[model samples]
Target: MSRTYVKVIPTVALLLIAGFSVSAWLVYSTSLGTDYSKYTFPLWTIPEGSHMYTQLRVGDLNGDGLDDVVVTGDYSLEAVFQNRTGGFENRTQILPSGSWDGFVLEDLNGDGSLDICALNATHDGTYLVTLSNSGTGAFAVASQYLLGPIRHVFPYRSHGSDVPDVGVYLLGDHNHIVLLHNNGSGHLTPDVYLSLTARNILDVLAADLDGDNQDEIITVQDNGNLTVWSKSASSRQFSNVSRYLDTVQAKRSAWLVIADMNGDGIQDVGLASNIGASRGVLVFLSGDSINVEQPIIERYYDYTWLGALASDLDSDTDTDIVLCTQQTVLVMENSQSGQIGGEIKFTGFITPHSPSVIALAGHPSPALIVLAEHRGWYDLNLIDLVVFWREERGILP
Candidate 1:
């Protein structure tokens, strides 16, 4: 089968600057100073032709301190790489045949061991791939469930929108969100199927939107609607909690992330819309309720494309926005005054067609930002960890 290549670019450099600002705030106290001189390692490229798409997640599947990398490819194969002292070692390849689109790594079975949930392109379905952290990283196919049905599938093409349609060949259809639950006993099951009104569903994120301990589902539809769904404790089923926001005009592509953008205890939703005149918005909620007081932040960027992940790049309490434009990755800092701070652009960095993923430690320290680029052959690029001290201080050196 011929595989399609997508170039994953890092969002604008505003995220890097945000990381520096946060680090400076933590160390310097008053002045904003960063140390970019320290060099840990040079930029290196991983093996090529991995057909990697989307952001790569780093976690220790074997209980080792070193993080293990999990990535989905254009084909059905999902690769697991072990992070060694110098580079990454291919540990195992699990699935062999369908196109894998989206993936999440979590202890779904509640077993303390991390497993993977992967979305298949061929059938608009999801599969649970279980990894036994036993000695050598052995993997097993747990379960597979169809999310629902896709209205239309489109081929992978760059129609000026930052959102890439994995391998969908058509357009104009309703996509379903597939949530997988580990059923223990070495099995996985589909927990929720979310239907949306938009032509396409760009991304689905899980977060504690309300005070409830369970994570709520937040999906960004192609029609620019941010739909929030919560699971019932008794039924273990998902229902639409509320339509958080539908302020923006319908756009083909957008990225969604859940973060406390305003330093409030509640998590806020940040939508990075990659329309022709690229612009982003931050919607802060009082709680899990759809009552949004101020949805839009004052400062907006023109032609700023949204990156793969919308996260708290800077350690600031608010979630920062990352945009990868034609040239430069911009990182915007969160401001209480409703205005975003200055942007930090990283020159000389090439973004793959896939989105960049951020690796955060449970404690305070610099986190690794993984960018998988397409270099003729499939190769994974490891960008320098844009360090941050506090969530508010911004990106550090």
Candidate 2:
């Protein structure tokens, strides 16, 4: 063949191959949902004293524009600051040794800085310790309120106010709920309190489930009972109550999360339970009425799930679930019709606890943070921070 003909043939073949490669990639990107490309081996390990880390959260604590991690454990409150190199090597202690269970970050004093409300539940009594952050991001103990026998405290905001109200869920003999109003002074006082007959309360969360301006308090209890309370017409307290039973065979609710699972505007409920034969994951689709007979999406697995978090892992508009089971970590994608779609699994994580989605310091997209018992190269079984993110949105230095 002539030289000109050979060169022309090679050029045409190259053009066709390039065009096909681009087409293939487009199809794969559209079809491939929930692609968690890489997983880091334990970002931070718990030492001897701090054994079990219960809660983990990431935020711009120092106002450096880069997100930092804050964790709570048995009598421990630590912060992992992200440095200039995008590495979390600079560790600091936020609060002195105390039995800190969980905390919420909010601007309690209206200083535009996120303050910390660390809840301490001890045998003496339960207390809400408010840590006010100065303009320079240094937090000092501002005030403390004695909330008797409350197991969990969550932030509840209503009427579009910048100030957040605190929701306290009382367990044991109290068996009640209280809404603590923040009066722009870092002091939380009981504004409204209600007594409930529901026993064995596992978790309590607040959200506007009916798209109403008012928020509803949802409580997951034993014997497959899910009770919701709405603010009364007087707006003084939560008096209107509705109860749902046998929700996905979830007798004993382990963990609960409230988010819009589907693209629908209403927020749905997610539950994880390891009670007896009912060990599985369940999602309650919120409609005009969330009754006991409401539709539910459930999946039963061999291993018990520790917790589940909702995030749009595939860039799909709808939310998906990331479950941390004792056996492994599973990512369940959402379908176009708002059902559970594909499954993505990650192994080798022992006793994985909480799975959270946070925007890391260097990553553009949100990353998944899981706390798991890792037997690392040192051969020590310690709770480690397992981080994972999508490959396309690479982690920057």
lDDT of each: 0.46, 0.60
TM-score, cand. 1 = 0.65
TM-score winner: 2
TM-score of 2: 0.78
Question: Model 2 lDDT vs. the true structure?
Answer: 0.60
- What is the C-alpha lDDT profile of model 2 across 27-138, one tens digit per residue? 0000112132122323444456454536776667788776667777666677766555434555667885767777887778787777889887668788888888885557
Query: In candidate 1, how many clashes are counted?
Result: 51
Which regions of candidate 2 are displaced past 4 Å? Answer: 1-53, 84-86, 135-137, 232-234, 247-253, 345-365, 372-381, 394-397
Instruction: Tell me the tens digit of each residue's lDDT in model 1 across 83-118.
Output: 433244554566666666555555544455666655
In candidate 1, stretches whose alpha carbon ends up further than 4 angstroms from where it belongs are 1-20, 23-55, 76-86, 122-136, 146-181, 191-199, 235-239, 244-247, 277-289, 296-299, 304-319, 335-342, 345-348, 351-366, 376-397
TM-score for each of the candidates: 0.65, 0.78
